[model samples]
Target: MMSRVAGLFRPKEAPVVEQEILSEKTAADKEANVISHSQNDNSSPSADKSPDTKWETEEILSDVQAGIQDVEALAKVWTRWSLIVAYITIWFIYFVDAMQQGMSTTLTPYVTSAFKSHSLTAATSIFSNLIGGLFKLPLAKVLDIWGRPQGFTAMMVCLTIGLAMMAACNNVETYAAGQVFYWVGYNGISYTISVFIADTSALKNRALMLAFAASPYIITVWISGPLADAFYHGPGFRWGFGSFAIITPAICTPLLALFYFNYRKARQMGLIPERKSDRTFLQSLKHYVIEFDAVGLLLITGGLALFLLPFSLYAQQPLGWKSPMLIAFFVVGGLLIMAFAGYEKFVAPKTFIPYELLMDRTVLGACVLAGVLFVSFYIWDSYFSSFLQVVNGLDITKSSYIMNIYSLGSCFWSIIVGVLIRTTGRFKWLALYFGVPVTILGVGLMAHFRQPDVNIGYIVMCQIFIAVAGGTLVICEQMAVMAATTHQYIAVVLAIESMFSNVGGAIGSTVAAAIWNGVFPKKLADHLPVELQGNVTSIVASLETQLSYPLGSATRVAIQKAYGDAQRIMIIASTVIQVLSIISVVAWRDIKVKDFKQVKGLVV
Candidate 1:
């Protein structure tokens, strides 16, 4: 019985050991199973695990959605007032340009009368302006580096001084020098502003801005022409020109202030990231100077100077085509121009112009088209007032009012075309489909213009037609050119186009003047009776002298026929050039418009 009791006590210890072993075994088994399950889950696909794993991707998608919404909201905040300000700034600058440009028409007669030479007027107007054109490329580079405000401010100051000089000048030399300063100052500042506007505006809205920019030239014509005439005759003639000294500074102050404020805003908003330059200021200046093509500048400027000098001098003194100086200017100037072309092509390290643009097919085409259009523009503008005064016997103010009709047609149609371009993403097809034929028809109609014999209503209609057609063509041309190149090359392309257009204008003016001079005098002498011929010549010599032709009679008939013939010939010739321009338009390479990225602090 004692042995049995001891066994039972030992058995209790064994039971306890068995219980502990079972628990330990279970714990080990559970840990192994968890590890194995985790490996399998990681290796294989499963629905329950996916949501937890994709959380990061879902978060990214939400962020992107929010970003897009923010962008859209920001775009909505960009108001029309910004664009309005830009338009007004451009208008102010171009209005000044108009005063200078039209000042020539009024000033020319006074200049010639003062100098006692008819040729001096043409020489001073054309050559001094050409010198200004020559300065444009360098000024553009300066604008790019120093920014528009400083460049424009400096130029305006120079221009104001130039005008003051012109107003006070007592001699022809001082007057001519003043013209040079005026041209250099005006062209450098105003032309750069045009480029600056191009840089700022989106492609879609550029035409509208440009139209507004071009508007002041037209709008000012209505006011300035009459104002110039009125003032030239008025007691305040000297004061009228001098007043610009004060007015220019007043106009510039607001623009400069805005420029500074905009620049500060751009910095705060991080619009353009700052670039670090290794060179010192002096080094940078040296680099810019060394890189500028001095030889190209010299040849090009000299060529223009030589070529224009004779043309400007021709109408004033020793009025013969075959004068030794004239022959030398034509020959030497032509040779120098060819040399400049060669230098630009083969030798220059930093070209004054981008010569490769000349070789590019699309750029070349646009240039030709712009040249023809501008040629027509200058011809009508330069001669039209004289035409109205002499042939129509209308006063300057009335003729200017009539010219407003042309401006109205242009302004209206250009806005329409700009809207069309923005909507369509197309340029040439519309012009080809609607514009070319219309322009030709307009030119043809204008060619038939005569004196009182031609219907005044028809003449006005013709002006409207030319303006509409020409406006559309120019807008299309601008769009095509802008589309062809990137921002880096736009300025040089513009400069080249301007250079060629100036050449075209010079040639057209010279040729037209020559033809008119030949036809008018000979016809006046031949048609009138022997007794009346001397009187007619005397009146021709003194264009200011009051001379009346019989109403609806033989002498008036002959004069009208002569005027009609001269105008028709010039118009027909201009039309033929324009037809060639249309052919040039066919070669433009097409570009798809891309939307501009919204810059954070852009004013417009």
Candidate 2:
């Protein structure tokens, strides 16, 4: 209670008020005070209204007012530089973060191959992100109490060590352990950085800062493939992951030191308040952890694991859907989720995620739309390479180039959509108006794809269209989700969405991969001779060696025919996924713009 009273006197932390504007408001207040003082003096003139006393008070007031103006001028200078400094700092940190994520993709195929694993080992990537997402909530609370710079710096240190450990690993256990460390650190730091940007930036520049921060994600996704290839194929893959450990510290350390100095400087200037609270760390833990709904977290996590595990293990040689272990995983996971909703309704204080949010039209709609968009992205990213390989007859490097095209499309659209949303507040209609048709057209076109030679130009166009539509939905969802809730909950909401996206990607990849691999082989057999039908993998290996031959001639017609049929089947599955995404958008509620205001007990 005393802490709450202290906040009433604490100065607001933000961009300093302009000196001229400050002077005008102060002078107006002084004029009123002077008039009141004069009236009081007249009422009690006999008490003594000496000239010297009046002059002394006036001089003191003048000194204080001039001192305030000087302080204001200095504050303005710091504010401008702080924005620039922060942008550069976040940019550098985020660059390496994205680079690491991108580098992982290149490492996965090699890592699995080295270990002699039959599966794609993409689940390692999912598990890494899963660990990261799980840590985001705890990290969010930590940032609120410890301050952003300190929180960010601590997480970065873990990240650096984690990367170093992974680079030195020679076995799968050590490698997985190293991955856990890297992910835990990466998720915490990235999440805290996001909150810091939201807290420190102004309304005008918030979207721009967010867009710049997110740039590294797609940029690295595009660049990491070639960069990793260059390093891994030449020096070693270990060196590839190790490169991040060295480079990241160089990028992060200077920014962290600068942020610390600036934060201190701001606090002293009365731009940021010294937020001391009565509650102990133990109290905070109890309040957030013990008070939160554990059942909900368990249910959601279980549901996601059940839905994703099948895909993670699908492509393995000894795949089995009817095994006792698989049945146990699904049955128990399903029951736990069903019980989660019942717990939510009966539990007191509820979970960290309120049931109310699930019912909120805008918030719920955004989640559904996000799931669809995520599914599309999963299929595009996971299957596009296979498509290029089978239909376009491209090698790993060439197929990667085609996949990078989507990242380029995403990058350009992210910035464009950010600017558009900020300029036009009609974000709801912007999504529904644009999302519905482009999604339908793009997914519909993908369903009908055939051999690259038939119309390669058209295929690329359709992919780009889907990319734009998906990008638009991503930006709109960010706005809607943030706008729908209090700023204090924004970090939690984003983390939830991030978790869902991970789940969606896992499910989409599994389902799409299953469809393509399951149906395409049968289709391939229909046109090819019975002897050649069963040897699909060998046929593709043979086709690669025969790339110079006329793609349309009878000599390679069988291969082309097989590839075309497979491509069509995958596209058909994608269309069905896209339609489900559209249906999910129907539940989304429109959210309104809100200003940043302090919420008691929740300083974030």
Specify the highest-lDDT model's number.
1
Q: Model 2 misses residue 207 by how many Å? A: 3.1
The worst-scoring run of ten residues by lDDT in candidate 2 lies at 14-23
How high is each candidate's TM-score?
Answer: 0.76, 0.72
Best by TM-score: 1
lDDT of each candidate versus the true structure: 0.60, 0.57
Worst 10 residues of 1 by lDDT: 13-22
Candidate 2 per-residue C-alpha lDDT over 137-196 given as tens digits, one digit per residue, 9 for 90 to 100: 545545544555666777888888878887888865567667767877776777777666
Q: What is the C-alpha RMSD of each candidate to the true structure, in Å?
A: 21.5, 11.3
